[model samples]
Target: MTNNDIFKKLRVALKLRDDDIVKILSLVDFRISKSELGAFFRKEDHPKYMECGDQILRNFLNGLVIHLRGPRPEKTNNKPQKKSNN
Candidate 1:
């Protein structure tokens, strides 16, 4: 239900280690240290436990998409080329 819970589940389901996650996040230009990432998976009672924020989750999801499907192709101009008198 909580963001942290969702993050934890996804981490397990994806079989992603901390290093893999860091690389995945980089795909979207989201920078995160392994220690900070670990904090999100810690028990709530732990002093270093940090709640996962929506921005982090959203970025991770976006990066994951790129990781699985590769980055989207660059957009191309749709207009017809103008004729030139050679």
Candidate 2:
């Protein structure tokens, strides 16, 4: 399954709104906009990630698992491109 599809399914399963997702991600130190999240959900691809850009599916799956399974020690193999903390 695609990242977007997985994300949508997870969100539905969790019964979370976009705002709720934003809040949850904030708790984990990952900030993203609702529009971006919507785009990710609407599109057939995962949104670009600052910490796991190269690992699109992995990044999304990790996020879903974290949301469902709660926070855990992060495991990242590939370095991600740095984005300015705007």
Candidate 3:
């Protein structure tokens, strides 16, 4: 499933309304219009505003994850590090 699909699914699983999502977003100081919010719910692609910045999108995802998955975890880089010893 797409990321947006996962988000929407989480929204339903959490019993959160679109207005609820919009409200939570506003509570975190991210201003988004109801029409734009509606488009996000209906979108088959990532919302443009979300893709525009890491902080905003991260905050949004963090909120949703908190609602569905519970507290946020620290992000980790799983990539293997290159070793250089000369």
Candidate 4:
């Protein structure tokens, strides 16, 4: 299936509205206008239909991950590095 198809399916499965998608994408620092986002969901034959790019899909997935699972905790470095002799 095309990226558009996958995107459309995910939108339906998640029951995400245009605003929700905008927020989800923002989580990953990806900014997309509602009009642009709407283009992705348009019918293929429509004049305004825009093909979904890999970058957009990838960022959406990353954002979705953060949406479903909270942000990853910061790593703690308990071991100190040893000093090297010159």
Candidate 5:
């Protein structure tokens, strides 16, 4: 229903710990502290409960992509060689 809900479910399903999540987020150049991450998992009624934002969710999804599939390879230019008749 909510971003926090979705994030919580995914984290459980993926069996990811706080550190693992931090690493995954880092893969996409998104930085999140462990304490901030913990807030997302807190109960809704809890004082430290923090709603997950679109940017954070989007970055997590992007980072998950890189984490699972590995980073894309860099492209290089290579000119075709001319053939000579023997």
Candidate 6:
């Protein structure tokens, strides 16, 4: 199946709206306009239909990972203090 098909199915399965999708894509530093996203959902025959590219799909998947599971926690450096004997 094409990337567009996969994207459309995922969107419906996740019950995601345009805004939600935009946010999800943004999670991975991918920026997309609402109108551009709408183009992906349009019927093939529609003049405004825009084919989903591999990069868009890849980014969406990466973003979805962060969306579903919260972003990875930051690492902390904790050094134990040395004891001083008088």
- Among the numbered candidates, top TM-score falls to 4
Q: By summed lDDT, which 10 consecutive residues of candidate 1 come out lowest?
A: 1-10
Point out the higher-scoring one by TM-score: 3 or 5: 5
Clashes of 4: 0
Stretches of candidate 1 off by over 4 Å are: 79-86
Clashing residue pairs, candidate 4? none
lDDT tens per residue, model 3, 1-86: 55556656767887887787776776556787776666546644544533224554566776665655665688999999999999
> Which ranges of candidate 4 are over 4 A from the true structure?
80-86
In terms of lDDT, the poorest run of 10 residues in model 2 is 49-58
Q: Write the per-residue lDDT of candidate 2 for residues 1-86, one digit (tens) a residue.
A: 65556667877987889887777666556777887666766543445532223344455555666777787877888878899998
lDDT of 2: 0.64
> So what's the TM-score on candidate 3?
0.52
Q: What are the C-alpha RMSDs, in order, of all predicted structures?
A: 2.2, 14.4, 9.4, 2.7, 3.1, 3.1
How well is each residue in 10-81 modelled by candidate 5, as lDDT tens digits?
999999999999999999888999999999999999999999999999999999999999998889768888
Candidate 4 whole-model C-alpha lDDT, 0 to 1: 0.97
Model 3, residue pairs in steric clash: none
- State TM-scores per candidate: 0.88, 0.53, 0.52, 0.89, 0.85, 0.83
Q: Best-fitting candidate, measured by lDDT?
A: 4
lDDT, candidate 6, 17-79, per-residue tens: 999999999999999999999999999999999999999999999999999999989988788
Badly placed stretches (over 4 Å) of model 3 are 43-57, 64-86
Better of 1 and 2 by lDDT: 1
Query: Model 4: per-residue lDDT, tens digit, 1-86?
Result: 99999999999999999999999999999999999999999999999999999999999999999999988789999898999999
Cα error of candidate 3 at position 19, Å: 1.5
For residue 18, give model 5's deviation from the true position in Å. Answer: 0.2
